[model samples]
Every structure is written in C-alpha cells, then in structure tokens.
Target: MAKAQDKEAKAAAKKARKQASKERRQQLWQAFQMQRKEDKRLIPYMVGLFVLIVAIFVGLGLLFGSVWLLLPLGIVLGLLAAFILFGRRVQRTVYTRAEGQPGAAGWALGNMRGQWRVKQAVSGNAHLDAVHRVIGKPGVILVGEGSATRVKPLLAQEKKKAARVVGDTPIYEIVVGNDDGQIPLNKLERHINKLPKNIDGKRMETLEGRLSALGGRNPQGPGMPKGPMPGNAKVRGMQRTARRKG
Candidate 1:
C-alpha cells in the first residue's frame, strides 16, 4: 500500500510539472507574438533561414545520394536555425529597450553566465547615473552608466575604495554607451568575457569575500533593482528556452 501510494504521488508531481511547462511555453509564445508586432523583420528572417537551410541540406544530399536520410536532418537544422535567430532577435530587442535605462549595466552583468558576483548601484546620484561592481576571475570590474562627465568621477572614487581593500588585484573599468571609447550595450557581455583571467577560482572567492565586507550602496541613497528591468522578461524567457534546448 505504501509503494502504491508513493507511485500515485510521483504521478501527480509529474503531471504538475507537465502543466507548468505547458504554461511557460504558452507564455513564451504570447511574448514572441507581441514582439513580432514591433519586430517587422522576424517572420522574414525565419523564412529566409528555413530556405537557406533547406538549400544547403538538399544540395549535400544530391551529391551524397542520401536524400531520404538528409531530408529529416534538413528539417531539424532549419528548426534550430529558426530558434537561434529568434533568440538573437529577442536579445537585440532586450538590449534596445534596456539601453539608457538606469541599472541596465547591473542587469546585463547579472545575466552573464559563470560565477561572477554582481553588486548593483554601488554608487549613484540624483541624475540616475550609477556604478555597478562585478567580481569574477578577472578581478574587480567597475561599470558606469549615464553621463560620461559625471560617471567618470564616480567610477574613479569607487575604484580607489575598491583598491584600498583589494590590494594588487587587477581592476578593470568599463563605461556602457555608444559614444567614442565606450562599449556598446549589446557588446558589453562579450567585452567583459574577453578580459584576461588574472585570478583562479579560489582567488576569486577570496576577493568576493573582501568586497562583501566593504558593503554596497549607502542606505540613504536610491537603489536600482538587482534583476532585469520591467518589459525585459522576454529576454530572460529566451535564455531559459535556449538552455532547455541545449
């Protein structure tokens, strides 16, 4: 009787998970539809991707004389291509919306893969200009967003404070914007990823601990949300879908 009851409970849990997954997919589909209304190129891009994949696979099959074997492979590749293109579009849309918004730099850092520790709104002023700090294998990275003239001083001050605590640890600075000498919002993640990894995992943990002791923004100052901003849920949804598909 105990075993039978256990099986029933397991079945119920499985059914609940299936329902949750179905709902999530429905939500993603609805989000995609709404995005398509603004992204006029989405359908055309998918159609072009399908046509290109079919052409390449059909050509290879003709040369190999394995048309049947390659036909299904072609369909699979086409679908994968469509999915990737969709993800890219979603990412672009997210960045476009996030650009110039307060806390966007922190949001981007939070979404990055790996073991980096992010502290949002470490320093800011009434103008909405802010500095966010990230601790990773590369050491401390200070990212500033908002007016270059104002943010330069904020980043400098934060760097000095961080330097006092993390002696000899390499500190890299980045400004997020489209202006000269600034990294574009879309390329921010790639830029950080390319930085030289100066420290190992153990050292990274040590550095994170030291910075944590320094604490974050002043309790009296305004704070930006640590997660992605509103209307950017679709980007997170796309990331989830890609992870599951992978």
Candidate 2:
C-alpha cells in the first residue's frame, strides 16, 4: 500500500511538472510569435505534427496487436520523438535569425528552453565572440564561439583557470561556427547535455563555490579587466601558437 501511494505521488508530481513545462513553453512560443511575425503559422503546424505522430503510433500499436503495455509506451515515445523534431525546428529558426549578428550566441543561449543553467556573455568580445562555461555532472564544458584561432586561445586560458579550482575535473572545449571543427548551432546544447557526467552534484556545488571568487562577470578579455585573474585564467595557448608560426 505504501509503495502504491509512493507511485501515485510520483506520477502526480511528474504530471504537474509536465503541465508547468507546457505552460512555460506556450508562453515562450507566444512571446516569440509576437516578435517573429513569420513564425505565427508554425504554431499550429507544430501542434498538429505532434498530434499526428501520436495518433499514428497509437494506430500502429492497435493494428499490429501489440502487448497492452505497448500502447501507452508507444504513445509516449512517439510524442517524445515528435517534440524533439519540433524543438530542432525551433532551434533552426532561432539560429537563422541570429546568424551573423553581434551577440547572436548570447541571444541563442539566453532564450534556450527548459531548465538549463547558462551564464550569458560569460566571457566575450564586443563583436559577440564569446566563451560560455556550463558546470554540471557532465563536467566542465567550455563552449567558444568566434574565430577559430581566437577561440582556441580563449578555451585554453579558461581551461587552465577552471582547473585551478576544479582540481582533476574533466574539461571539454568546442568552437561554434561553420569551420572544419565547429559544432553546428542547431545541435550544440543537445551535444553538451548528452555528455557523460564526470563530476557529481556535490562536487559541482563545491567547484561553483570556488569559482565565485574569480570574477562576477567572465569578462570580454583575459582578466575580465575588472577583476584579478583568478588562480586559473591563463593565456598561454595564443602565445604558443604565435611562437610556433613565428
């Protein structure tokens, strides 16, 4: 009986969270629609697509005479798949709008959906070239977007800085653009979030605590220009590359 009650409670909480997320997505879509006059038609199509996918999955399970459990399972899986496509379309639209604009990365990140904890303009240039670090169990992800040459230096410097406070934590870096090595903007967040978590929740909290003393703002340049270069921020990558070429 207790187990049953616990299951019931869990189900209720999950439903509540889903409803809240839907409401938030609706509000966000509505706001996006206002500013994006062209996307107004997409709202209904997006909904209809999801509904159609769900109906098909349900019909398939019934027609195939699958196990009773497959009905709900298929419906859920189908909806997830449809929404994922829906989400990608939304991202592509945003990426299109933000293309080549100053601070485009900042805006793309700022408007990211769901509960991603992102710090904006973390460390960036006036031209909107920037590096954003997101810390979680997936370890330290250093995302750099700008000139490949410039961003590499920034990535190395910040990695060093993060290491001082992060100890032996895992660090990953990627440049965002259409370069030979860059990850496309459409799939950036999914790629980051799907990485294996290296640090546990507690360690992340500790690392964040240590990182707070570094700089309130990640600064556009090496030292934030406004604060002391924490024990970790180093700019050696650029220097070494220069020497190698020279």
Best by lDDT: 1
Error of 2 at 115 (Å): 6.6
Winner by TM-score: 1
**Which 10 consecutive positions of candidate 1 have the poorest summed lDDT?**
237-246
Per-residue error (Å), model 1, residue 209: 1.4
Off by over 4 Å in 1: 218-221, 225-246
Score residue 61 of candidate 2 by CA lDDT. Answer: 70
User: How far in Å is the alpha carbon of 4 misplaced in model 1?
Assistant: 3.8
The sequence of per-residue lDDT tens digits that candidate 2 reaches over residues 126-194 is 544677767767777777877777767767877888788878888888777877778876567667767
Error of 1 at 110 (Å): 1.7
Q: Which ranges in model 2 have alpha carbons more than 4 Å from their true place?
A: 1-88, 110-117, 217-246
